[model samples]
Target: MTFSAFLWMTFGIFGTLAIFSFLYKDNPFYKFAEHLVVGVSAGYFVIILWHNGLTPNLFQRLADGDWYFLFLNSSKPWYLIPAILGAMMWTRFSAQYAWLSRWPMAMYIGIATGIAVPLEMANRINKQLFAMMEPIDFANFFGTQGFDLLDPTSGLSQLIVFVGAMCALIYFYFSKAHEGVFGRVATVGIYTLMIGFGASFGYTVMARISLFINRIQAIEAWRATGFDESNPEYHGGFPAVFWVILLGVVAYAIVEIYQHRNRPPQSEEPSA
Candidate 1:
């Protein structure tokens, strides 16, 4: 068909194969794809910087000779502020001016750390606590309203979940010793937290598996000109695409094994 359609198909086929490269335990093909992704991302960032930061703001502001607007816009751009800060940042290149670099670095660090602590603590504690303590209706669980374990209103699973969440939070309190009453109880909470974390991890892994299955489905849906079984396009079940994936992976694994077999010997150097 058209070149654009062919290009799309080509990329799709190759991307699918690239993901399967994981089975080979990493190789040049996987590395090539990885570098391609990084290169494309860097190119995108350069284009964005040119349009948003450099072109409209710096260049245009300099062209218009507007000092206030120059901080944002420019045409024949002086770009003094960023240029100065950028120059200050490069002061690290000189032994004498290296300490000057610390001012900007400290400012960045102070602002970042200041904002992060409160937000991180609130997200970790308050949100999790309220979520764990939400309302659960019990009438649906046991058929009879009296003794239903599954219904959140019945307070069985919810109690366990709540205890687990609270205990887990307490496990992080380092100011007091865990050997005391609260600390002993907090240890049990640690178990609950581990269970919760494990469940979340399992869910995330399943989501990745679902994405992998979706890619396979996409490849299966691609149609071409193959009316008869004897045609070259028939390719048994899948197309030549499957073999490329299967062999690419096999080749990668073989290379990995060979590399490992040829690894250099470890040294037994003394530590200070």
Candidate 2:
């Protein structure tokens, strides 16, 4: 294999094994992997923000005025206002002048909220209400073709959705006391919510499992091919790095067992 590919593969295998070692016990390997991930992610974000965000969006725009159609220009000196506001955020690091940072933060929050609220209302709330307001067509229920209750996207499914949503909303209506029929409907709502949560959890677990399987498949492919683009079917079996890590873990476990066996026990102290 090429030197660069081999080096990358080694690092990948070692990082994966180190992370998985946490299942055995909290150890230096797990800590190292965790810290490495955090550090790398933070560093990468900083680099991306500098190169993609700060440079092109702010500094370059200020330096070189943007002219559109040779008649309209937008990159005026006023562009420095946002840059100044962004710089004001760093004032939070100062002990005495930390309050100065709040101006920029407040501006950011206000602008973001102003932009997001209308979009959220239109996309989420309005759309959900419209979906729940589906027409109850009796003709479709008793048409020439018999109704299929098992069809998930049928009128029956829509009715169930509407009922579930209304019940859940009623359960959250704290103004009215949940007694008699209200209590029963609220109980059904709670069960519906629990089923929804369980399904969501199962989906999340399956997604994670799929990701894990994909990574394993990639590793197995690399092991079989030896990461050598020159030789498509090298048939190297497992990488040497994987074997080294496996042996190291086994050795560490053996040493830990030996240490636990030979170590002296603590004597009990007298009760006060």
lDDT against the true structure, each candidate: 0.70, 0.78
lDDT of 1 at 19: 59
lDDT value, residue 174 of candidate 2: 86
Error of 1 at 203 (Å): 1.3
CA shift at 49, candidate 2, in angstroms?
0.8
Q: Candidate 2 on 227-248: residue-level lDDT in tens?
A: 4545665535435655776788
The segments of candidate 2 whose C-alpha lies over 4 angstroms from its true place after superposition are 64-75, 142-153, 175-177, 227-251, 268-272
For model 1, the superposed segments whose C-alpha errors exceed 4 Å read 61-63, 66-79, 93-96, 114-162, 169-187, 221-272
What lDDT score is found at residue 2 in candidate 2?
65
Question: For model 1, how does the per-residue alpha-carbon lDDT over 155-180 read when each residue is reduced to its tens digit?
Answer: 56666677776788788888888887
